[model samples]
Each structure stands twice: as structure tokens, then as C-alpha cells.
Target: MRREIKYSDNYLIKQLPKATAYVNRDLSVAHISDSWLNNFNFSSKNVKKNNILKAFPTLTTKWKQDIDYAFLGFKNTTKTDKYFDSNIDECWLEWTILPWFDEEENVIGSIIQVADVTENFLLKQKLEKLEILIAVKSEIAKIGSWEYNAVNDKLHWSDMTKIIHEVADNFVSTIENALNFYKPGKNQRRITEYLDQSLKNGATWNDKFQIITAKGKEIWVIATGKPLFEDEKFIGIIGTIQDITEDVLAQQKIKESENLLRTLINHLPLNVFVKDLDSKKILVNQSECDYLNLTSEEIIGKNDFDLYDDETAQIIRGEDLKILNTLEPILGKETIITLKDGQKNNFLTSKIPLFNEDNDVVCLMGFSMDITPIKQKEEQLKLLINISAIQNKKLLNFAHIVSHNLRSHTANFSMLLGFLIKEADEEEREKLLEMLIDASDNLLETIDNLNEVLEINTNPVQEKKNIHANTEIGAVLKSLKLLIKNKRTHITNQITEDIYIKGVPTYVNNILTSIISNAIQFGQDISENKIEISANKIKGYTIITIKDNGIGINLEKNKDKIFGMYNTFHELEKTRGVSLYISKHQIEAMNGKFIINSKVGKGTTFKIYFNEND
Candidate 1:
């Protein structure tokens, strides 16, 4: 049989599996278990009977004090500390130090136990870091989280969630009280529905709605919620809320601006259109559609080539291309278009390039206006200017004529009277008296003619009627028949009876009588002097020609003065030099033209042009 061996208390303590050590009152190591040696990387000879603080140089002063407290019979104390082993690897230690009792229950020393808690300590640090990260992110994004407990009828709001609501940190909120933070009507009702759906059907919800903050200010928020479940039973709801007031208001303003612009352009009277880079129509206002005689649906997506002739389309396309390439605007470009109905219209058009954020031409905007009426008015203005210039020249001639004729007649009368008063011979005195009387009659006749010229000048417009040229010419010839006989002049009237002219009757008779009388008077020196009259229609005018073989005028020398008053070509007692001047004025007043062809001895020809009548 084997001998029975007894195990002592020290041997039994050294065999313990935990890292345990027994120390004396002086903190000297009395005994240590096998795990204790392994944990500290020590052997029995190095640690037994050695001071515990000296054997483990890593133990801090606080650990020594706690061991001393255990010697005073205090309850067990536990502490955790960071440690670096011989290899400098990081470790965490949980030390439990308690007093050891003798058989009489008196404390003798302390027993210290240690555990390696490195894994648990690292996990706890990670959890703390993650919580800090979540808090920072929530604050930056203006987002917050909340949870509701149906069992306790309580609501939990995170720190950021309370801040979002503008509530105190110590604020206590329940589910009903939390719902009150939403706006009164629609927001509150919607939130309630969302919660109900989440609770009953375990659904998730996301919505954007309005809310009232604790300060009684309204704001916009985006909210999301998900039902919480445990063992297939609904328990509560968890969700997130974010403040989005600025974003929501900005979107609203953008929409309102778009609507206002649409209303303004649609109601304008000018033609407005927008086109893409390809010259295809994108947008057009009502006025543009009306001008094109097409609806918006028909015009959109179409180019100039689809709506206009090839020539017009090419012109428009060229302009659009220039604007896009140069990024410049063409303003007030005048264009003319001939419509399908053969009517021509004028337009003032403008086109400008539209740019994108990168300062690139993306599209073009155009405006057009009809300017045909303005162009017509300009043409009328030019015609009026020509008429004004002609009237001004006529007035200047009349002024010079009046002043010159009056002065010449008065001087002649003065000299003739002086000769009559000084002559003693009755025959000579009577001759001077007759001469003075003739001068007086000439002056009176001159005054009457001047008065007629004044009337014509002041009233440039005359009432015109159709007069037969042949009958009028016959009447003039008969009135001057005695003079024609005395002058031995032969007059031939070849003006056809069917010919008619538009003129004032008085002006027509005056013109004919002056020309015929002049022919008869000037032909006295020529034997069988002949005058011929003829008429023919040319263009829009009836041209009457009067040819005479008489004392012809030197037109090259007196061309400028031929139609001037008191400018007589021949030295004759009856030549007053007023008839041709008056006749020319009358012709112009009737909107007719007077042209003269003459040579010093070859003869003279007068051509009068009047409007041709039916």
C-alpha cells in the first residue's frame, strides 16, 4: 500500500489555477500560485519571500495603498490598470486585492488576484469613439434621432434631437407631447398617420413636412421612421428628423420666379422665341405664334427652313450661326419679307446668344417687330420735301419781279412828264403827253399781272376741270385773228378734237393766248410767217407743241432769264416780257411742265405737257 501524504496550505495555495499571491503586512511576497508566476513571467526562487512591489516594478503607488488597506481588514478592492509586458505589448489588468484571515479571524496579510482584460477594454474604447463620431455627424447635418417606448409611454430624444426642437437639455417629453411640436393642422395630422401606420403595419416612412419649434417659429423638416419589433411584436418606433427650412424656401422661390416669367412673356405684344443650338425652336410666346400663323405645337421643334422659303431661311440661319459662334447679339436688324399673298412687310429683329454656366453659347433668344408703317411714312416725308423746295424757289422769283418792274415803270413816267412840262411846241408837248399816258397804262397793266402772280403764289392748289384742247386752241386763234392778219401770220391748228387735258379753265386760256399773241407779234418782220400747233399722248402726259417761224430767242445766251419778268428779248414798243413768265407759273401750278426750244434765227418751239385724261 502507498503511504498517505498530507498537502500543506502553502502547497495547496500554490496549486490554484488563478493568478493569486499572498503578501505579508510589509507587502513582501509570502506565496504565489503557478498562474501568478506565469502572468508576471517569474519563477518561485525570484518571487517567494521577495517584496511584492520590488518583484513587480510595474505596480503603481495606488496599488500599494490598496494592498495596505486590505491589511486593515477592509472589504475586497478591485482596480484596472494598463500594463506593458516584457515585450512592450499593451495589456489591461483587473486586480482584486482582499485580506487573508488566520484561524482566529484576524487579518495576517493580503491576497491579490489579477486577470488579463485586454480584449474587453479595447472593445469598450471602440464603443466610446463610435458614440462621439455619431454625435458630431448629427450636429453637422442638423439631424437628430428619437425613440418611443410603448410599454412605458415614454419618449427618448438624443441631444441633437432636443437641440433641433429648440428645447432645454433637461426637457422631458412623452409621445403626445412630442407630436405637438409639429404644425397644428396638416403637419400634425400627417405625422400622426405615419406613426399609426408604422405601429400597426410595422412600416417605414419618409416625409417632408412643417414643424413649429419651441420658440413658436415655423420651419421645414424631413422625417423618417421605422417600427421597432421584438419577437414579432410591435414595441415602439425609431426615426430621424432633419431641419431643411432654407432648402425648402429656396425651391419655392425658384418655382415662383419661373411662373412669373411665363406669365409676363406670354402676355407681351412683341414676338419672342427661344431656340436650341441646332436652331430648332424650343419656346415661343403667343405673339410669335400669331405672327407665324401657326400654333405652338406646330412650331416647336421646327427650324427656320421648315417655315420660310429657302432664301429667307438661309439668311436667318446665317445670323443665328454668327451669334452662336461669336457669342454676340444682333440688335435692330431690319429685314423685309414677301408674304405668300404678295404683300411685303418690314421687320426689326434682334437675336442674342444664351449662355450656360461655363460661359458657352447654348441657345439663342429672338425678338421681332413689324416696322412697315414707319417705312411708308418715311417715303411720304421725302415727297413732301421735294414739293416744299419747288414752292420756295417760286416765291423768291416773285419777290425779285415785283421790286424790279415797279421801279422801272415809275422812272419812265417821271422822265416823260418832265419832257412834257418843259416843251413849248404844242406838237412836241402832245407827243410827250402821249408817251407819259402810255407809260401810265403799262404800269397799271403790270400791277394787275403782279396781283395775279401773288394769288397764284399764295394759293398753290387749284381746282382743275377737263378742257378740250382743240376747241380752246380754236377760240384763241379766232380772238387773235386780226393781229394774225396784220402780221401776215398763218396759223395751223392740228390739235385733234379727241384730245383733252386737265387744268383750271382760266389758266388754260391764259397760257394759249400768251403763246399765240407772242407768235403773231414777233412774226411781223417775216413774210408769210407760219405757226403750227399739234398734240400727242406720251407716257402719262398729253404733250402740245407750238412751232413758229418768227424772231426766235437766243436761248444759249438768255436761257436762265428766258422765263424771268421784265426780260424782253426783242426791242419792241409792245414787248412787256411778262407773258411767258406768267404762263410758265400757271403751267407749274396745274402740275404741268413747260419746255422751250429756240435758236437766234432758226425759230422757237414751245412744248407744254399736261396730265392725259380719259
Candidate 2:
């Protein structure tokens, strides 16, 4: 329903006295002032001639009896109303009704005045809640509040405060009594001085002091006070004080234990230090001073930059900042530091971040432990390990080649001798003898190959030269001419004469000879024997690709053993299988990569990558 808006009460309300309002004994809509009408959203056009209960449905008609009683010459009647409005939540109203009279002193009507007590009522409610909460907190925490009013010259203390002071519940408080409660010595004088200066300069203070209670017992307490102000003018001091005797004693024990630990650490032989977020040194022990060959005074307040060279200092500072940001500990950081005297020292260091109660990194604490002797021992072990690895590797390869070759030779001899024993003709015996000689020769060649590998490893750092690839390929081809003619092999060489790579000449020749020979021997199976050699430079490395139409090795079945010592996949040709293994090692030693990619029926492709710098 749309209610009609009205403002007829505005003119009549403006004619009333400051707060004049009188209701007839009916307790109907009394005259309301313009201020009250504007403030309370009331209007004569809306509320006049209406009962009080109907105008503001929150009221009771029972108030009309009090209005009638007040008009019967009784004293003014007062009442407070508390109710909830749908729009305004909680509302508090107070009204005072007095007997209204004419000049003839006859009681006529009841004059009523109203006050919106919402603010004061809400404040009273909050204070009640706070008092209950304070009571709970005080019991649990042993803390209390107090205030001193300089103008009234009175000191007020909460119940918790009185209990802390060990005073009677009804004890009369005075400035003299308060001051006297402090121990007759420094506590009294200090508190007196603090209060005088605090009042004079309006300064705040927070300190721990001992107080002599009413029972003459000495106890420590933390007292904090701030100058109370009204309109920017200092009035008095008010703050909280907590009995901190137990906390103070615990802290003292902890401090004593910390001192003992610090002394023990300083005596031990470790270089320990503390630094702030800005990398400024905060603490350093005797060992750190001795290590730096400087007094503590010289080392303190200095950062890594002030003590070490820029590069080393920056490396250290970076780690420090990382710890500060992460609040994490970094352990076992090893580095070599060169000092101002040009003496290099090896140190194993660690850092940890210090934090406050809020878990924010307050500072960083780290220690540098000299590990020169341990590092020296480590280097020695590494050198021995290197020598052992090299020797073990060469010995293994030698054994592999020797075992395969010796077995081949012995088997050939056994077969030949058996054939000779069974033969009746002298011609057959002579042929078997010749075959034995060939077997022994192959064994000797295998031994020679082992020797060559030994030499290569003995001087692994053999000096290399820039050699032309096409010339090397041509030489290998010419050397294998008889085999190539036997196999009916066709060769295609695409290497430029000027295209160069760095490698040992003997090794390079051996690699090309072995690969080319394999191509010719295996390509003999194909109807048309074919081989192609090409080279290109990509990304500073010379890449050589060798392709051939041949019976490609089935890498799927033998992939794992392809470069292993004495490992062979083919049975069509007599082989000792040491070539591929040694070639791979030698190529890698020269900072090159060796790759072979092939399929079962498709031909084989070998790619070699040679580093230009090598």
C-alpha cells in the first residue's frame, strides 16, 4: 500500500517551546517539537488524533495511567523503553512526563519529553561485554589495567590489579600509598621519576620493575603507561600492567644458559658469524677473528664485500640473500676463498636464517669451516681414481681382444691337426700346415691391434693435426683396392680435398679403413656393391656420413653390444670385433661423436661428428 506523504505537523511543531510536549490524559499524539518531528520522522498530518500505541506501534497504552497520575499532582514519572524495529534494529527511548499547569496552578495535562538513548545504551552494552571478557582474560593471563587522573588526583585500578597488588578489596588508594607499595629503593625512585617526567613531557614508558606488595613480598611486574590526552592536552597516564615474575625468572635462566652456550661456542674451533639482511656483520667469535687474523673489532660490522674480493664476496652475498628470502638453511657449501694476503683457503660453509615470532627473517647466521686438509685428501683420491680407471679400461680391452683371438687361433689349430691325423695323403697334410700358419698370423695381427690400443690410451692426449678428409679416404680406398676389386665394390667419394678436421692421423686412417672394409666385405652379398662418403659442416662440427648398399647389421638384436669389446653380430666374415669398440673410444677422446643408424634390409649409415676446436 502506498502511504500518502504529509507535512502538516511542521508548522504547529515549530510553535512549541524548546522541548514542550503535553499529552491529554488519553496518552494520544502529544504535541511534538519541529526538531523532534524532523529527527524522529513524525508529522501532525500523519500522527495527530492518533493514539500513542497506534502512532508508534512499539508503545503500550499503560503509559497513559502514569500520565494521568502525574496530572493528579504527583511527581514527574520517568520510564525507559527498549524495543527492536524492523528497519532500525535496536532502539532505546526514554521519556519524562510531568504535570502540566496553567497560571492558576491547576494540573491540566501531562507534558512529556523524549530522548533517543540508542548511543548511550549501546555503549553500556559494549562495556558490559568488555568487562566480562576482561575478567576472563585477567584470570588466565594475570594482567590488569589501571588509570591515573591528574585533575581529580585519583588512581583507579581494576579488580585484577588490586589482586596483583595483594591489597584489601576496600583499601583506600592514595598517591603516597601507591608510591610506597614499590620497594623502598630503586623501584620507588624510578617509578616516581618516570611518572613525573611522563606527566611533564607526556611521554610513554614500558618497563619491568620489582614491587613490594602490601604483604611485603617482592615480585617482578611489567608496567606500561602512556600519557592520556584530551583535546591534545595531556591529562594523566593509563595503561596495562602484568605480573611477569615467572616470565622474568624464566628469561633470566634462559639468558644464563645462552651465555654458557655462547662461551662454549667461542672456545671451540669454528668460524661462526651472524649477519643482518643488509649483509652487515653482527657477531663474530674468537675463532673467526683468529682465522681472519684480525681483532673482533675489525671483523665486526663488516660484510663479505669489506673483507673479501668482489667476486668471492658477491658469491657469498648472493647465498645470504637467498637464505634471507627463503628462511631456509643451506648446508655444505664448499668454495675456495682467496684472502687479502693471496692465500687460498678451502672452506665448507653453511647458513641459516633467524626469525622473529612472526616468522619473518630477522637475520642470517652462517659459519665457514676450513677444510683444507680434507680437500687435499679428496684431490689425492681423485687422482688415484683417474689413474686406476684408465689402467682398468685399457687392461679390459686388451683381455677382450686377446681372449677372442686366442680362441680363434687355438680352434683352427685343433681342427687342422685333427684333419692331418685323419688324412692319408701328404698333400692334405701340407695344406693343413699352411692353414695353421694363416691362423697364427691372424692371432699376431690381433695382438698388434691390442698393442696399438694400448699406445693410444697410454698417451690419450696425443697431438692432433688438421688433415684433409678426402685425402684420408682416398688413401684408405687405395690401400683396400684388392679387397674392393674382389668384392666388385663401387665407391663414391664426396669429401672436398680442402675439408679438414683435427684427429690423430693413425687413428683416422684406422677408422676409415675399418668402416670401408666392412662396407666392401658386407656389400659383397648385394648384387651391386655400392658405398658413398660425404662430409658437411654444421654448427662448428664437421659431420661425415658413410652410406653403403650392404647386408646391414641387425642393430635391433645387437644394439646393446654394438660397441662392446669383442662383440660381433655377423657370422659371414671372420672377425675379432675389437675395431668398433676402440674406434668409438678414440673418437670420443677427440671430442667427437660416433653414430650408426640402420635397418634390417635397408643399408647401413654411419655418421661421425668431429669438433672443430679439437
Candidate 3:
């Protein structure tokens, strides 16, 4: 295959279609291809005998020297013209200069071929810039490329891979060493399993696992790989690996915080709930669910509309909406719920609007405490207040009666006794003495009433005994026999003899005697002094009803004051309101209740109940 061209090959060179030309050792144009002359805009007949540099004035000085070197038997000497055109800025050209020799191996002339390569050169520049951009992006993303050769069992990693592994640049890598960098337990097993499966089924893998670096730092990473194949035969694998420790750690922390929040709220005793603006329950604690007689699964995601009557639901919704509109807290608001058992329960609750980062009212947070027992106690306290008011008013009235009535009676006694001592006439002295004696007796009566009021107030609890109600009423009637006979009062006792009540025997006797005597004394235009007393067992208590045909009280105006101390609504001088007042206290102290009903000019009825055993 070794050969050389002689001067006779000038015809062959000139016959080529390229922009080719030949020059003698003198550098004069000796031959030119017809295609070459046409391409360069030159006529072969006029260009044939000119020296190479003289024909192309744009040629540099070095061109002639390079042609002379070619003429010294150098073949295929190459060069390029980067700024080949006089009018174009991006013009470029390539030249291949070959030596034409004689049969004796002496240089005869040189052949020159020219081509324009401007387009290809521009394309090469663009490709080099794109590759640099890709490499920079991979480094910034912590992405590293890897490849494995099945035939030679070789593993090759990019520079980025070595950097991620925290190893020296000169570190030599192998399959075994790379696998060792992965965590020794589950991580290593996962990789081996994925690799084997991918090799068997030509499958692709993209998974996250942990790895230990050369510096022994533990980190999370994501590996993505696809099985590599050539000519439909399995060859190796190639893929990318990325460091993703920060992302995984953040996700783990978020999960832990959510779990902690759930645990704390679940353990609280107060009924707590959170609702969105739509009034649907977003979160409910165990206490809230229990208060509603439901489980969290049933209560959450539901609103009042689902759990209550329309009227109740509307009321609750209005409260929630107010909180949302005002973005304020509502505290110590009492709410009543009628339970399924038809018993009403009271709850004291607090509601506050919850806001988002943007300062928008997004939810409502509420706390509720069951306060039914407290409300009951509150009612009891109110009753006690009314009773105390009654007692204080009675005490004030008793003080007034004592001051006015006792002072008047005592002053009369002093004046009457003084007159008796000074009077000389026997009849006048005797009359004044009688007056003094009557005044003294009235003073004693007032003192006794005041003493009884004081005694009743000082001792709230009294000793009691199980006594037959009929026996007590009978004894009271017998003691008042002389007055009843004089007044012609007819008392009818219809009580069962065995009906018993636990009470102070003296109080029971006094209460019965005073009531019966009043009935007889207050009788108005009656054909006979009529009074009826009866007793029976009813509703876990013994009831005693005393009925009479008498001039009854004007209860519409005087019922409130009927038992007030020293009050007298009638013209009857024997009526002192202190008796009924004392009777009420004695009955209450014995755990009994007394009720009275009366009508003006008609009749009166008194009902008393004592606990069955009392």
C-alpha cells in the first residue's frame, strides 16, 4: 500500500471535484481543478500560471512557507483559516496540503484542498456550553452519576459521587467498597435485594435509605437506577444518587409534634372542642364526646344541627357565629341541655375564636364544665336568703311590739299604783289598785310573747318523740274544754288514733290547741261553732287537714303577713299573729310542713304533713 504520486498525476488532481490546486517547487500554479476554479470564482485559463501568493492577496505570509514544506515531500499537511472572508465576521475554512512527488522520490509540487467548516464549528461551541451547565446543575442538586459494568465487574462513579461519600479524590472505588458505605443492616439488605431483582427482571428501582460516609457521618439518601442493556442483552446498570437528609428529618419532626398534641388533649378532664368557621367539629377531646353521650368518631365532623333540635341548634349556632364575627372570647355562659332522660343539665362554658397566621378567624375553641349540681345549690341559697329575710323582718317587728306594748303597760302600772297610794277615799284607792293589777298582768303577757319569740330563734333543732296525732289533738281539746263550753264551739275530730308523727310533744299540743281555739273564736254568724280535724297517710307522709266554718282571713291581701309576729288583721282583740309564727317554726324544726288556705267571710283549711315515721 506504500506509494507516491509523480508529476504525471497532475491531471488526476486537476480532475478532482474539490477546490483543489497544484503548484510547482517554484510555488507557481501548475494545475487547477475545473470545480475548484468555478468554486473560487476564478477562470482556469487566466489563473494557471500565477504564483500561489500573487493570485490570492488575502493569503498570509505563513501560507507560502507551509506550501514550501509540503513541497519537501510532506504529505497531508493541514491548516485552517479562522477569518477566511474579507466581508464576513464568522467565516472559517480548512486546508489539506499534500506533496506531489516524481517517480525518483524527489518533490515536484504540492496539492491544496480547501473547505468551509463555519457551521460545524459553531455547533461544537454550543454543545460544550450545554455540557458545562448540566455538570453545574448536578453538583448543586447533590446528584451523582454511577455506572456498573457486568462483563468486567467494574464500578465507576463521577467526581460528585466521591464528594458525597466524603472520600479523597484519589480514592479508588469498587462494588464491594461502595456497598460497604451503605448502612450495614437493613440498608445493605435493601440494596442487594433491589439489585438482584432488577438484574433478574430488568426492573427499575428508585428508593430512599440511609448511608454512612467515609467520615462516619450518618445521612439519608435517595437512589434511582435502571438496568442497562445492550443489543437486548443485560449489561449493567446506571443511575443517580442524591443526599436528602434534611427533607426526611423535617418530615419526621412534624409527625412527632402532631402525635404529642393529640396525646395531651386526650388526657384533659375539661370538655374541649375545636370547630371550623362552618361550625363543623374539627377536633373533639374525649371529655367533649363523653359529655355529649357519644364517641369521638360520632361527634367529630358534626355540628349542633346534627345533634340537637332545630331550636336548640339555632341558639348554639348563633353563639358560635357571634364569637366568629367579633373574634372575642365568651366566658362563663350558662347553657341548658335537656338530656334523653328528660332531666335538664346545666353547663358553664367558654368560647374563643381561633385565628390563623394571617389573622383571620378560622376556628372556634370551646371549653365546658358540667354545673348542674352547682346550679341546684345556687337555687337552695336563694331560698335560704328569702327565709333569712322573713326571720329578720319578724325580729324587727318583735322589737317594735316589745318597745311600744311593754312600755305602755308598765307606764300604766306605775301611774295606777302611784294614784292608789295617794288616794284617801277607800273606793278610789281600791279602783286604782285593781287597775294596777290588770296593767301588771298585761305586762306579763307581753313579756311571755317576747320570751317565746327569743326562745324559738335561739334554738333551731328541738328534741322530738313519736306521738299519736289523735292523742295530742284530744288533749288540746280537753284543755280548752271550759272556753269551748262557754263559746258553744263544736269541734269534730275524725283522725285515726294510731296515726303517728315524730315531733316535740309540747309544740304539737300548742299548735293544735291554738288553731282550734282560733277557729272557735273567729266564727262569724254561725249557727254552731263548727271545726273539723282529720288525718290520713298520703305520699310517704301523714296529712292532717283541719276545716272550719268561720270568719276566714282576707288571704288575697293578708296571706303574706298572716304569720308575721304581732300582726292582727281582724278587729278581734284575741288575735295575735305571734301564735301562727311560732307554730311555723316549731313544725319546721320537727321536719314537718304547714299550709293554709282561707277565703274572706267563707271558711279556712289547714293542711299539715309530717314524715310517715315522724
The best candidate by lDDT is 1
lDDT of 1 by residue, 91-159 (tens): 888888898777677888888888888889999899999888888889888899999888787889988
| CA-lDDT, candidates in order | 0.84, 0.79, 0.80
Which residue pairs in candidate 2 have backbone atoms (N, alpha carbon, C) closer than 3 angstroms, thus clashing? none
Off by over 4 Å in 2: 1-20, 25-38, 61-76, 82-90, 98-110, 123-158, 192-207, 222-242, 274-283, 295-303, 310-335, 348-367, 371-614
State the lDDT of candidate 2 residue by residue for 504-578, as single tens digits.
787788778887887788774655688999999999788888998787888878888888767877776577577
For candidate 3, what's the RMSD? Answer: 8.1
Candidate number that wins on lDDT, 1 or 2: 1
Predicted candidate 2: what Cα RMSD to the true structure? Answer: 16.9
Tell me the lDDT of candidate 1. Answer: 0.84
Q: In the order shown, what is each candidate's alpha-carbon RMSD? A: 9.6, 16.9, 8.1
Candidate number with greatest TM-score: 3
Across residues 235-260, which tens digit of lDDT does each residue of candidate 3 receive? 99998889888888998998898889
Q: Give candidate 1 regions above 4 Å deviation.
A: 1-209, 221-242, 251-357, 363-389, 464-503, 508-559, 568-575, 590-592, 595-614
Look at candidate 1 and give me any clashing residue pairs: none
| TM per candidate | 0.57, 0.47, 0.65
Ten contiguous residues minimizing lDDT sum, candidate 2: 1-10
